[model samples]
Target: MSTRRYILDTNVLLQDPLAIYAFDENEVVIPAVVLEEVDSKKRNMDEIGRNARYVARLIDELREEGKLHLGVKLTNGGTFRVELNHRSFGKMKEHFLERTNDNRILAVALNMRIEEEEKQSGITVTLVSKDALLRVKADALGIHVEDFLSDRVVQYDRMYTGYKELSSESKQIDELFENKKLLIKDSPISNSYPNQFFILKDEVNPSRSALGMTSKDGNYLESFVSSEEPIWGIRARNVQQRMAFELLTRDDIPLVTLAGKAGTGKTLLSLAAGLYQTEDLQKYKKLLVARPVVPVGKDIGYLPGEKEEKLRPWMQPIFDNLEYLFNTKKPGELEQILAGMGSIQVEALTYIRGRSIPEQFIIIDEAQNLTKHEVKTILTRVGEGSKIVLMGDPKQIDHPYLDEYTNGLTYVTERLKHLSETGHVKLQKGERSGLAQMAADLL
Candidate 1:
C-alpha cells in the first residue's frame, strides 16, 4: 500500500497541537506560510494563541531530530516536513487569490500533488484543513481535501441527547414507579450511562409512562431526586427541564451538560440551578459563570472602558438571567444585588485559565464555542468539591474552526456520558416567549 501525504492547514495544527502525530504511518507536510500564520497569532491571549505557541514548540522540537525541510521521522512511523511554496503565483492566480495565505498553502499542496504525478507514483496527497473555504478551493483545483476528523466526537445529528424512551411491559414500568428502582438489565435497554434519564412507557398502554434516571451506581433505574422542587423561584417547565433540574441539584453528579436551541432555557435553567445549589442549599461556596468570547458577527473593535466595562456587553446575557433569577424590579439593580451577595463571579473564558477554583458552582455558558482541548483545560481546572455545568446549543456554535459535532459541549457530553459523575440533558422546548419561540422555529 502506498503511504498518503497529508498537508495540514494552520487552523488544523492550532486546533490540536498534537495533530502532527495523529496520522500514523503517513507523511505530514506543513506549508512554510502556515508557520508564518502561526507566528503572527502566538501573542494572542486566547486558547488559539496558547495552541500556536505549543505547536511552534512542537515543530521546533521535531526540528532537533533532523532538518524539517528534508523531513524527520515521527513516533507514529510517519515523516514530517515543512514544505515551501514551490509553485509560481501565476499558476494558481486563476483559481485562487494571488498572494493570500490560504492560496499559498494551497500552492504547496498543489506542488506536492504535481511532483508525485510527475514521478508516476501511486501515492496520494491530501490536504487536511478545518477551513471550509480552503477545502472548496482545493476541490476547484482538483486536489484531494478532508477535515481533521481526529478531534470530532460524533456527528451532530447522532449526538447523545442524554434521554432515551423505551417501551416496556406495563408490569415492568409499574415496578419502576412502585419500587422506585429497577435493575437496568431487566429492561430492553442494553447500555446505560450513570445519570441517563429515561421515559419508560408501557407497551400495552402507551399513555402509561414514568420518568427515571440511571442510579448513581449506574446499575439501577430510579425516579428523579426531588424533581418537583422549584429551583431559585423557577419551576421546571417541561419534562427535559425537570430532568435537568434533577441532575443539576444532585451533589453526587459533579458534571452536567445541557444542549438545546436558543430560548430553550438552557442558560436560564443553569443559572437558576447554580443559584439553588450555591445560595439556597449552600452546596458550594460561590458561583462562577463564564462563556467563550466568540463573536457572532464582525468584531466591533475594542470597547472604551475597564476590564469589567469591556466585559459588560459579552456578559450581559448572563446578567440578564441573573436579574431574572433575582427578580430585580429596577434597571441596574442587579449590579447592586450581585455586589451585596458577593458570591457570584462572572468572567470571560480567557482569564479562567491558570487558576484553581474549588468548592464553586462553575457554569460555562456558550460552551459549544470551545474546542475539545479548551474544554479539557476548563474541566481540569475544577478543584475538589466543585461542580461544573457546561451549557450550550450545539447548533449555535460561533467558532470558525468548530462545528456542531466537534465543539466542546458535544465532545464532553458524548465522551463522558457514561460516567457516574456526569449527567446530560438536551432541552427541547423553548420557554423564552411565544415570539422568540416562533422566531427560533421560523428563522
Candidate 2:
C-alpha cells in the first residue's frame, strides 16, 4: 500500500500528546505553525499546558535522533517531520485572509496536497483536527480532514447504559424472586458484565417483571438488595434510580458512574447516597462533593473573594441540592450548617490533585466536562476505604475538547463496566419536574 500523510492540528496534540504515534506506517506531518501554537500554550497551568509541554518534549527528543525539519523515524514505523516550507499562504489567502494559526496549518495541508498531485506521488494527504470549522474549511479547499478519534471510547448512540432488559420464563422470574439468585446459564442473556442491572420480564406475560443485577462473579443474577426505605428523605422514584442507589450504597463497589440528561436525578441521587453513607451509616468519614468548574456559555472572567466565595457561583447547583437535603430554606443558612458539620466538604476538583483521600464518600458532579486523563488523575487520588461516584449528563458537556462519547464520565462507564468493584447506571427518566423533564427531552 502507498504511504499516506496525516497533518495534525495543534488541538489534536493538546487533546492527546501521543497522537503522533497513532498513525501506523503513515507519515505524520506537524506544521511549523502548529508548533508555534503549542509554544504559546506551554506556560498555561492547566491540563492543556501540561499536554503542550509534553508534546514539545517528545518533539525535542525526536530532534536528537535526526533533523526534525528533514524528518525522523517514529517507533511505530512512521515518519515525523516539521513542515516549514509550506509557510506561504498561497491560494489559501484568497479565501481566509485572517492569517491566523489555524489558516497557517491549513495552508501546509493544502500545499502538501498540491505538491503530491504535481509529483503524482500516489500519496494521500489528510488533515487531522478537532476543530469543526477548520475541517469545513479544509474540505472546501479540497483537502481531506478527520477528527481525532483515538480517545473516543464509544459512539454516543451505542454508549453503555449500564442496564438491559431480558425476557425470561414466568417460572424463572418466580425462581429469581424466590431464591433471590438465578444462575446466569438459565437466563436469556448469553453474557453479563459484573454489577450490570437487568429488567427481567416473563416471556409469556411481559408485565410480570423483576429487577436483578449480575453477581460480582458473573455467575448469578441476583435481586436488587437496596431497601424501600428513604435515604436522607429521598426515595428512588424509578427503576434506574433504584439501580443507581444500589450501586451508590454498596461498600464493596469503590467506583460508581451515573450518566443521564438534565433533571434525571443523577446529582441528587448521588448526593443522597453519599450523605447516607457518610452521615447516617457511618461507613465513610466525610462526604466530599466536587465538580469541574466549566462554564456553560462565555466565561465571566475571575471572581474576587476567598476560595469558598469564589466557588459559590460555580457550585451553586450542588448547594441547591444540599439545601434541599438539609431542609434549610433561609439564605446563608446552609453555609452555617456546613461549617458546623466538618465531615461534609464541598470543593472544586482543581485542588484534588496529589491528595490521598481515604474513608470518604466522594461525589464528582459535572464529570462530563472532564477529560479521560483528568479522570485518571482524580481516581488515582482515592485511597483505601473510599468510594468515588462520578455523575454527569454527557449530552450537556461544556468542555471545549470533549463531546458526549469522549467525556470522562462516558469513558469510565464503558471501560470499567466489567470490573467487580465498579458499578454504573444511566438514568433515563427525569425526576426533577414535569417542565424540567420536557425541557430535557424536547429542548
Candidate 3:
C-alpha cells in the first residue's frame, strides 16, 4: 500500500510525541512551527510541558542519525520531516485572535496541499489534530482532517467493566465463587476482557449471588467485592448507578473510582451517596468534594481574580450540583448547610496535601486531571475510617500527559477494581439531559 502522509499538529506532539508509531510506519510530517511550539512548552509544569520536553529529546536523538529538515528514519521505519513552509503572513488575514496558534499549524498543512497539487500526483496531505476546532477550520479550506483515533471509545456508549453474569445451577455458582473464577456464557456477566472484575449477583436478590472474575481473555477474570455494607439507593436511575450506589456506601470498599464520559453522573451519584451517608445515616463525620483545578485546554491565569475568583471556573460544576441538590433552598442556603454541618467541604486538591482524613466520605472530582503521583499522594493520605470516592471522566481529561486509559483515575480503576475492598461501576448512560447526552455521544 502507498504510504499516507500525516501532518502532526502541535497538540498531537504535546499529547504523545511517540504517536508516530500508530500509523503503520506511514510518512509523518511535523511542521517547523510545531517544533518551535514544542520548545516554548518544554518548561511547563503540567503534562503538556513534560510531553514538549519529551518530543524535543526525541527529535534530537533522531538528528544524531541524519538531517531532520530533509528526513529522519523513525524506529517504526517511517520517514519523518519538519516542514518549514515559511511564507509572509502579510498575505493572510489577521484577526484579534492572531495570537491563536492553531491557525498557524493549519497554514502549514494548507501549504503542503498546494505543493502536492503542483507535483502532478494526488498526495493526501491530511492534517491530523486533536483540536476539534482546528479540524473544522481545515474543512472550511477544503483540506482533509482527522482526529487521532487511538484514545477513542469502542462505542460511544461502551466502557470496560470487569463483570460478567452466568445462569448456572446454584451448585455451579457456588463452585465458581469458591474458585474465584468462572466460564459462563458470553452475556454481560461473561463478556469482559482480562483484568475485568465483577460481582455475579443473584440477579434475583443481587445480594445473594457469588462474586467471580473474568480472565484476561475473559478466561474467568477473577476477583470480587464481597465487602459487606448496608444496601441503599437500590432504585438508582440505571443498573450501573445502582451498582455504584452499593459500592460508594460501603466502608469495606475503602477506595472506589468511577470513570466515563461527561454527564455520566459519576460526580452526582457519588455526592448523593456521600450526602445520604454523612447527613442522613450519620456514618461519617464529614462529606468532602474536591477536584484538581486544571482546565480542559488552559488554566484560569488569564482571567484575573483571587483564589475564590480564580477557583470559580473549576468549582462551578460542583456548585451547580449543589444548587440542584438544594434546589428548594435560597441562594447560598447550600453554603449555609455546608457551614452548619461543617460536614460538606468543596476543596482544591492542593490544600489536601499532607492531611490524613478519617471517618470522612470524600469525593475527589476530576481525578483524571491528577498525575499518578498526585493520585498516590491523595490515596495514601487516607486514614482509618475513611471511604474515599474518586470520580472523573478519563476521556475528558484536562491534564496534558494522561489519556482515557492512562490517567490516574483509570490507572487506579484498572489496578484496584479486582479487590474485595474496592468496587467500580462505569455509568454509561448520560442522564443529565438530551443535549448533554447527545453531545457527550457525538462530540
| Local accuracy of candidate 3 as per-residue lDDT tens digits, 23-84 | 76678888877888899999886567777888988888888988888888877777887877
Query: Where does candidate 1 stray beyond 4 Å?
Result: 295-302
lDDT of all predictions: 0.86, 0.88, 0.71
TM-score of each model, paired residue for residue: 0.92, 0.96, 0.63
Name the runs in model 2 displaced over 4 angstroms. 186-190, 225-227, 295-302
Clashing pairs in 1: none
CA shift of 262, model 1, Å? 0.7
Compared with the true structure, what per-residue lDDT tens digits does model 2 show for residues 1-443?
A: 43699999999999899999999989999998899999998987777888899999999999998999988899989899999897778778789999888898988999899999999999999999999999999999999899999989896488888889888889889989999988887545538788898898899998889999889877888996674668999998999989999999888899999988888898888889988888889999999998777652223346887888888888899999999999997898998998898899988887676799999999999889888888988999998999999999888878877788888899898998889999998899999999999987888
Q: What is the lDDT of candidate 1?
A: 0.86
lDDT of 3 at 126: 91
lDDT of 1 by residue, 1-443 (tens): 33699999999988888998999989999989999999998987666888899999999999899999989999888999998647566568777666889988888888788888999888899999999988999988889999899878885478899899988888878788889988887545547777888898889989989999887666788886586877778898899999988888888989999989999988888898888888888989999998777652123247797888888888889988888888889987998988999999999887787699999999999998887877888899999999999998888877877788888899999999878889999999989999999999999
TM-score: model 3 vs. ground truth: 0.63
Residue 53 CA displacement from its true place in model 2, Å = 0.3
